[model samples]
Target: MRFAWKVFLSGILVTVIALSLTAYWLTQAAFGTALSQEKQKALDRMRMLSVVVESMAAEYSFSSEEAELAGVMRSAATGDFSSAALFSKDRRALYGRAGESAPMEELFEGAAAGLCHVILARDGGYDMHMLMPVQLGVATGYLYLAADVSAPFALSDEMTRTASLITCAAAVAAGAALVVVARLLTAPVRALSAVARAFSKGDYAGRAEVRCADEIGELTRDFNAMADSLEGHMRELAQQARRREDFVASFAHELKTPLTSIIGYADTLRSRALDEEERFRSANYIFTEGRRLERLSLKLLELMVLDRRDFPLRDILTGDVRERLTDALEAVLRGKYGVTLACALPEAAVRSEADLLQTMLVNLIDNAAKASKEGQTVTLTGRCCPAGYRMDVADEGAGIPEKELSRVREAFYMVDKSRSRARDGAGLGLALCDAIAGVIGTELHIESEQGRGTTVWFLLPYGEGEADAQ
Candidate 1:
């Protein structure tokens, strides 16, 4: 069943059982008390009559005393008393009502030593029979009084009916009140269930809004937290899937461009005889496109190898890093690209594979050179710190926009696609750098402002000899 109904019915059932038992006990106890009180009243009247009889017997003979007692008892008869009788010790009727007396010995045999009483029910009316031993100086007899108890019985029955009605009414009221209380108690649970259903229907943003200082409130808080975590993870997975799709599409397009050019030109060179100048131009174009394809293939291979290969790290000084970066940038600078580079290096040993570190730095510096204008200096800066050695490649180039910075590290994602394509950039430079940084336990941090410049930096873990070098 639903939680609210379970709580409501459980509370109502408990109240009904407890109330039923209480009503039954109280009604029976009240009935018993009323019956006892009526019996006591009958006993008291019988004793009073015995006193009057003994007083008369003190001044008269046995027969005369008996006769006078009968007359007195008949005169004393009221609606409550139905009959009165006197019996001898030997079990014979002496006076009072005719055909109603019984053997005294048999009546008193099972009774106690003193006065005794019993309630006799007949024709829906109750009669209390009270037996007492009578004494007049030297004579002894038994007095029996039968008092009609139908009035007390009727009162008791009326009370029972009234109590039953009250009990039933109270039960209904208690059930209603308990239902309200159960609803109030289970409100938080129901809210949580609703949110859970919404979540099942793919609404990850739905949350329970119960707020209190109880276990239910704690559960609500935990459920909301779980929903938030699930939503965040799903968003990350979706973004990753989109990025993968974009990377495949871009990589295929890049490959197809060079292949189409190479195929078309080779077919021309094979199909027709051309002038020497035209022939050299087609051959040079073919070779140039072929070189670009080679470069793209090599970069892709390097990225795959770095991802799968676990290289052992060793300490390499910052001076060595500067030398490697200079050597890698030498060819690009020599062809009158007019990109000047300035180096500011501090002496420190960084803990990393020398080759991977060199690749990361070369990609960064090459990217900076490509982004810079002729004669706009690129600075290679380094410093030693407590935690590691830091390097920054700052370029006086058109800076990337803030919104595109976060996505620039993704493979085949470019801030300026046309410009990167003109420079033979496959847009895998930063992706390579980022993978290298992760393998070496670091992160690539990029900061740039539009129209000013871009700075790419990261920290390498300090080697054992780094402190001495610093």
Candidate 2:
């Protein structure tokens, strides 16, 4: 059903079939070969006996050496045969030994005239014999020699059993090897299929493991490339949507502050009995909101411009880190929140951009100030790190939630919607901070918990300032 299943099954099926066919054919061939060799050897044994017996007959007829001939025949039997015989040209047994004596004519009875290896009885030994008539046309009695074939047959039987065992073992080993090859072949496919399923379920971060440099690896490379393209496109769309929403919210917040003050001023001026002090206060409120709106607009425009630029860092300088941090904090922390701002800056200079470093630190401190209670403390500390300088701004008020900390730095992203609007703030501080940090090559570090207050800071490469130069 699934692609991985198909791959696994296909591999296993091919291996099993191949092993089975090979074992069957090899076993058949081995059996045939062994049988042929055994049969040939049996025939050769019969032939060898023909030569031995013919010589014995010659000795008996030429030298009257019947005793020696019988002794030689008995020795050749190896105790596995009971009888061997030589008959004269008159169809009379010349030398007969079959456990007892018989008339020469009576014993020379059989009509077999060629070499033959015969299994004597159901429970006895085999006999390899050669019978040759001495004369051609008038063929009379011949020489007969016999030897047992039981040991050779037994040996052949043992070899056949051993061969069967070896074949079985080879088949088993082949099957195991096939299984291993099948699993190896199917592994990459299985990994890719799993990743594909994960991607289907909306996890674009899914990845497939590369197992080999074969076709499967090529396939995985293509699939991962496709996934990367899709993920980038999706992220682009999400970013565009968020930007649109942020623009609308920032505009509305900025407009509302000034419009509220303008409306108040208009109400006061319209009243017939308004005093001079009340008139001036109402007019001042209108101007104040307008100035706030102006500041919000300028900040937003600057952020937009910075966002389009590819700000790669160069022309770095070493400066007094403490002075830069204090200047930024003092400028930004002028609001009415009653919080102690603590700074622990090192009297050390490092390579960085001064203005960008100051801006980033100011924004982080400002964010912490907003999150702090009236009597809480916001502490700013600068320390030297392995790669660069570390700045920390920790607060003692309401902290951000564990999940929503990542989105807080987004333009117009307010964790507390109602409170943020009531404060007449445009929610651009963190966004501006993030942009400035990027321009100067630093990372914004934000940590938060529900009621434990929020901490936001930026670590920058420290650099030269006017104080350090002096």
Candidate 3:
């Protein structure tokens, strides 16, 4: 059964049982008291009748004939009495016919000694027989009186029936109230069940309404919280799936461009004899595309490693990081790219995985170098801030548009595709940097204008007790 019905039925059963027992007990007790009173009234009447017979026997002489004594007995047998009889000292019935087939000898003997009474069940009712000794002149007689005392028993039966009716009525009334109460109590549970069903059917927004400050309400709240968490995780999983799809498509496009160029150039060199200049040009094209392919493969490998592995952070001095970046960037940016590399860093210990941090910094500085023109400077600055050791890479190149800044970290997503391709950029540098920043428990914050410049910065927490490092 449903929970509400179970509760209702259980309550009804309890109410019926309790009311039944109470009514039964009350009816029995009242019946017993009334029956006792009826019995006492019957005995009293018997005694009064015996007194009247004794008075007559004393006033008149009844010892001469038995018919005279029987006449007195018949007169006394009036209102409640069913029958009356008289017995001599020898146990002879001298009055009305005896009603019950009892041992008269024993009754006469008991009467001679003292007044006695006995109640017997007869004809689905009760009868009380009283025996008393009456003195008649010089001799003594026994008066036997039988009275119908069945009215109390009849009343008791009627009371029992009435009690049963009351109990049933009470049970029905209580059952109705319990039905309402049970439904009210379980309403939240039903709502929660409905919400759960809807959620299972992919309606993540469904929620239970809490209507009371009970355990069921708390359960509803907890279920809503769990649903929220699950919905968030589902959305996150969907986004990850979309990202993987984009990454795959971008990866294929990057590979096709380089591989197609290399293959075409190689086929031309192999199929046809060309002049020295044309041959050199074809070979250089093949070599350049080959190099680009190699770079793309290395960046993809790094991204895969970052996704699959966990890196442990260690204490590294900011001065050492600055020196490494200068060595890695100064020669390439100045000689080849015609960009000056500038570093202004303090001596401080920051917690970071050394290789991942170096990779991130190199990518950022290289991107900055590529963005700048000859004599334009790419600045790498580090300082001790309240949050951590802060590092910024700023370039005064034609800055990224504000709209494009958000998507620049996506793999193979470049603001100027042709310009990026001319500089051998596969658009994976900022993507790799973003991944490295996540490994170091941080994120890149990039600020850019349409034409002014772009600044990319991130924070690394200070080493243990090394916040004051200088």
Candidate 4:
């Protein structure tokens, strides 16, 4: 059954049993005690009457004189005794309430039971009964007496009624008390059960409201903690899913760009109409595009491996930050754009992941070089932070807008989509840098004010103890 109903029924059943036993015991006890008191009173009266009769017999018997026996009967009529009678030893009634016969027949049939009480009548209605036998000796006549048992009978009946009333009231009180106790005890458990159901249905935010310092409250606290952990895990899973989708889409596009160029030039070379010069030009185009395709594939593979855990860290190398910055800037500035590469960096060797570090620098510097006016400096700055190191690649020309800075590192999130396409980017460059920075426990920060300039940089934590906030 439901919990509340079970508690209520149990309370009721217990109360009923308790009251029933109490009523039965009290009823029996009151009746028994009343009967005993009455019987004792009757016996006392019989004893007194017997004493008077014996004394009279001793003084007047066999003297040829008639004795007044009425005084003896009258003398036995005290408040404690009812009808007192004189009986011969042979079971003859001498006197009593005018034809009151004592049941000496019972004494002959069984033991006297020693002044026992029976149900009897004062005036023939059988209100209650008590009788006692008295004998001067084994040969003398006996005196018989019964108490006026009406009062005890009435009182016993009243006591039975009172006990019954009390039992009923007690039953009702016990039932109410038990019900209240059960509800108070089980409230926290019920609330916890409800919250468990809610949590089973996937509401990780569900909580039991049990607040006391007991088992139920401890269970509630544990449930809330589990939910908090589950929610955090779910959020992490969602974020990973988004990152995966972005990675796949961007990687596919990057691969397709070089593939399309290589295939187009190769097909041109295959056409039979092309002469030596034309074929040479086509083959050169194919060759260049093939190299670009090779680079794109290698970069994609490196990034994919880095994204997964269990990829071994390639050794930590100590290197001068300034030297690395110079090499990366020189490599990007080789184009006829005449973009000047400027480096401002610390001379000291810093711990770095060489391949990842070089690539990160190349991508930022290349992008800066692409956006710069010829003869303008694409300034590269390397500095040390409390955490390991920092590098900035900033360009003055055609600066990225402030609003798009945050999303710039996002895969394929080009602010100038058409211009980015002409620059022959696989669009995975910044995304690669961002991922590498994350793998090495660093952050890539970007800042731009519209029409001013854009600066892309990385912050490398100094040690494992360095604080990182995402």
Candidate 5:
């Protein structure tokens, strides 16, 4: 059954039962009081009739014969009594007729002792019979009186009918009220259920309104909280999916360019007889494209490894980190790129995964070198700050445009695509640095002005072993 119906029926059932019992008890009590009063009235009238009969019998000098006593009773009997009878002291009927079903022997025995009355039920009504022994001019006689006392019983029946009608009316009214109450009480639950259904159909914005400060309202709040969390997680997952899609597309395009060049140059060298200069040019092109492809594959592999693994950090002197980064990049930057390398180191220790930190620093400095002119300097600097040890790679290269800075960390995103391709840059350097920074529990911050230069920096929190570091 629906909850509303269950509530309504239960309320009605309780109302009917309670009201019925109360009505029955009240009617029965009233009927009992009325019947008692009626019985008393009947007995009082019977006593008065007995006294009148005694007075008449004495005044008329009545005999023990049935006809004489019957006349006396007929004259004396006036109110309430339907019939009167005279019985001899020996228990024989002497005057009026008595009921054959009446307890005559018992009535006679009671009268011989004292005045007595009994109410008897007969034919859907009641009769009160009274008997008493009287002295009739030295002759003992018994007077029997019967009064119809069914009025009180009829009144009781009427009261019962009225009570039943009242009980039924109360039940109906209560049922109507209960239905409204049930619906009001369950309104929040119904709203919550509707919201849940909508949410199941992918409507994450749906939420149940809290109507009151009750348990049901608390339930609605909890459900809304859960929905909010689910929606946020779903949005994050979708963003991750989009990033993956973009990464795959970019990766494929990068591979295609390098592989196409390598294949074209190799096919040219293989398929035709060429001059030494042309042959050397094709071979060199092939080798450069092959090297670019190799670098792209290695960077992709490193990115994947970073995603799949967790790196543990340990204390390393900031000076040592600077030396390692400078050593790793100085030869390539100064010799190959003709870029001057400079380092400004501080005496401090930072928490970092050594290999990952070095990899990230190398990428930053290499990018700095690539962006700089032959005589320009790429400077690596370290400073101890309250928050952490800050490291920066500042380059006097052509700075990135403000519009392209936001996307520079995306894989294969290059500010100057032609310039980058000419320098064999696959545009994965900053992307790889960003990933490494994340693994080290930090993030890369880049600052650049269009014509000035670019500065890439990160911070590593001070480590516990700072005092012992060189």
Candidate 6:
């Protein structure tokens, strides 16, 4: 059966058994007490009658054979007796009701008391039979009395029927009440079960309502917590799936662009009769595209490797960061882009993989220089914090729009696709920097406003060697 019904039926069974037993005991006790009291009252009346009979005998001499004896006995008998008789010592009935006889032989043969009381069954009813031996000086005989007890017994039977009916009604009410209570108790559990089923079927929005301060309430709370966690994990998984799909499509497109350029130019160099300048230009174009492909391949390999495991770290100072940024800027943009460098380096040291850190810095500075107008200053700043060294690379160029900032670190995503392609950008600079930063225990934070500028920053844990040196 269902849980509520099971509990209801069990409660009902216990109530029925308990109340029935109690009712039976109480009714029996009441009936027995009343019957005993009635019997005692009957005996008391019989004793009083014996005393009257003795007085009558003392006043007048009487014989069992005399008719006057019956008169005396009838005069002494009270109206409570259903039948009255005087039995001689020899067991002969001298006086009684018209047709009734006292069963003296069966009742008094081995009896010990001068007053004998017994219950006799007749015509499906009961009679209280009392026999009292009477003594009148030298004469002795038995006075017999019978009182109907069927009414009292009938009353007891009626009480039992009434008690049974009342108990049944009470049991039903208690059972129904218990069923409602059981339903109320299990309601939260039922709601939780439904929520779990819905969540399992991919409907994560369902939640359990916790309305009590009991174990069930605690369970409801725990269920909601687990559902929240599962929903979050599902969302993360979906985002990761979409990221992988976008990465594949972007990678294919990025690869196709350069390969197509190299192939087209190589075909021209091979199939066309060209002058020295035309042939040389086509070959150089192929070489330049080939070199761009090489850079993309190398960055892709680095990102894949960074994702797979932890990298070793070493002590490096913020001064070292400044020097590296200067050398890389001079090598890539010193005389080419007219990009000016500005530095604010502190005497702070950090723990990091030096090569990965340099590559991350190089990518950030290169992107910054590429974004800047000629004669615009690209600022590189580093300082010590309580936990580590923090660094910023900011460019005075067209800033990324706020909406596109979140995806700028995703592979092959660029804010200005055409500008990036024109500048020979493969759109992997920030993605590579982000991957490297993660490996080195940092996050790349990008902040920008359109028509203003963009700044990228991160922090590195303080090195143990630096701590000891300080």
Across 83-136, the per-residue lDDT of candidate 2 in tens digits comes to: 556555565555664322222333244434344333342254444443445421
How much is the lDDT of residue 392 in candidate 2?
A: 79
Q: Superpose all Cα atoms of candidate 5 onto the true structure and report the RMSD in Å to 1 decimal.
A: 9.2
Q: After superposition, how far is residue 120 of candidate 5 from its true place, in Å?
A: 4.5
Model 5, residue pairs in steric clash: none
Please provide, for model 6 over 289-376, each residue's C-alpha lDDT reduced to its tens digit, 9 standing for 90 to 100.
Answer: 5665566555544445223436667888778778655644553464556788788888777888776677677778778877888888
| CA lDDT, candidate 1, residue 42 | 78
For each candidate in the order shown, give its overall lDDT on alpha carbons: 0.73, 0.60, 0.78, 0.63, 0.78, 0.75
* TM-score for each predicted model, relative to the true structure: 0.56, 0.38, 0.57, 0.58, 0.57, 0.56
True lDDT of residue 439, candidate 2: 60
- Which candidate gets the maximum TM-score versus the true structure? 4
* Residue runs of model 5 more than 4 Å from their true location after superposition: 51-67, 99-125, 132-142, 236-247, 265-470
Off by over 4 Å in 4: 2-35, 57-107, 111-116, 119-144, 150-184, 205-210, 221-250, 269-404, 407-433, 440-445, 449-470
Model 2, CA-based lDDT? 0.60
Which lDDT value does model 1 have at 66? 62
Which residue segments of model 1 deviate by more than 4 Å?
Answer: 18-29, 58-82, 97-106, 136-139, 175-183, 265-470
Query: For model 1, what is the C-alpha lDDT against the true structure?
Result: 0.73
